[model samples]
Target chain A: MTAPRSTTTNEPTDPYVDLPVPDQRKQQSWRAQGPIVAMVALGGAVGASARYGASMVWPVAAGSFPWTTLWVNAVGCAVIGVFMVLITEVWAAHRLVRPFFGTGVLGGFTTFSTYALDIQKLVAGGHSRAGLAYLAATLCAALAAVWLAATVTRRLVAWRQR
Target chain B: MNWLLVICGAVVGAPMRYLTDRAVQKRHDTVFPWGTFTVNVVGCLILGLLSGAVATGAASSHVQLLLGTGLCGALTTYSTFSYETLRLAEDGARFFAAANVVASVVAGLGAAFVGVSCAEALWA
Candidate 1:
């Protein structure tokens, strides 16, 4: 005679497909994140300093638009794209370095705040068309530059890998 | 009287931006740059709100500098966003590149408009 059994039944789980498992390798790799942050911060400091220097060197000329800011943003965007490609594909840079140079430095170097301020100043000064033109150029050209940098990097990397 | 406040505001705003970017990156390990997008949109909105407030005299110059220059300046990042979008296109993620551009500009402007309108209404 069989004894009365409990109603609960446990099903066998597949370790690979059904069970949630922590990736130790991924976690270990992320140990590099701290260094990345430092790199980014360093990059930020450099970028900010460069921006200040640019402003001082090229004080706004008597113009309808703020040329200094436009130049800085455009240059910064292009540099960042180039930097990303160089570090990621060419150099295969350490992950920690990315934050400092890419996120922190270049990120800090570029300034949307200044961009907005410039636009406001232009609008306030009744140079609305100039302000709008500046905005368009910044948005479009910056994006294009980034795409170009990335494309160049990818092709180079592919050639190397092959 | 107010310049001190602006300085302090900038100090707080810039670091906050750095931290936020880090946090977003941690959560999403993809190279698509969700963090930059979020920061830019939020920063634009805040700037718009501050602009409206200052124009309406609802906020002080110090407050404006703190929130607008320091905070927003630190928060929104065009360089990184541009870089990442370009990276995606280069990596053959054309769809993502297109989406990033459209979404960032549209959302940023929309957020700014809403922020400005909200501030104007409240101050008025």
Candidate 2:
């Protein structure tokens, strides 16, 4: 495994980072969640598979930028933004449908852990410039993608009603 | 095949993430997105360990796909993190929003670095 580079941060650590909070939602019986669990699992499998396929199609060399992961995350983030508006505002679909698509499919498709690892690899591999560039670019692009997609989608929806 | 492993691993991982997030979110009323933060850090740690194992030949590529690619990848999410942070900023929680991004990124990378170091020590 690659050794960690000398990246330093002096940010004060929060003690409540892992603190357990009190449960506020009503407890649902496990029996009522059988179908919902199934939908998420099925959707997750498909989403992960698609991600794996993308990586395969556009394989990355070691210590290089991970374009496939970036593309998947950015695209997934945008889709989720647009999807939330549509499901909440436009469509009155089945309850499980949102879980399957939004929570399951899109959630599974976009990954945060891999993104972290990629950044770590890039930084540790003596490519700090590339790593920093990636970090900023991804954060900006993802947020922009979501905001743009949602704004345009909302406009389109409003226009349709006019 | 790797495909099968990915499917099976994700089948379990995704639901586990949902359940864990739900369970964690239920306990806290904070808008800090503790659920996503927890999962992302934990997943990074696991993936780092897995990467170490693969490097030391303690684990194979197939195992990496099953656990790292499928489980860890599906378990943690960027979309929710991004969306939550964006929402927090839009809602005038700039400090919390900035804290979320910095904390998640810094803590995640630190956890992963530690994990990799631990795994390397074990295999050494």
Give me the candidate number with maximum TM-score.
2
| Candidate 1 global CA lDDT score | 0.63
Cα lDDT of model 1 by residue, A52-117, tens digit: 567668888643677777777777787776776676447856545555665655666677756665
What are the lDDT figures for the candidates, one per model?
0.63, 0.78
The digit string of per-residue lDDT tens for model 1 on B1-124 reads 3434433444444445566765664554344556677778888878888888988999987777556655576566778677666656655667767788778777776777677778889897
Q: Which residue pairs in candidate 2 collide?
A: A21-B27, A22-B27, A23-B27
RMSD of each: 11.1, 7.8
Candidate number achieving the greatest lDDT relative to the actual structure: 2
Q: Write the per-residue lDDT of candidate 2 for residues A11-100, one digit (tens) a residue.
A: 101111222233344344454466777888888888899899999999999888788888999998899778877876799768687668
**What's the C-alpha lDDT at position B70 in model 1?**
50
| Model 2 alpha-carbon drift over 4 Å, by segment | A1-28
TM-score of each: 0.69, 0.88
Report DockQ per prediction, comma-separated: 0.24, 0.44
Residue ranges of candidate 1 with Cα displaced over 4 Å: A1-46, A52-63, A92-96, A113-128, A147-162, B1-15, B25-32, B58-62
lDDT score, candidate 2: 0.78
Fold similarity of candidate 1's chain A to the true chain A, as a TM-score: 0.69
Candidate 1 interface RMSD (Å) = 12.7
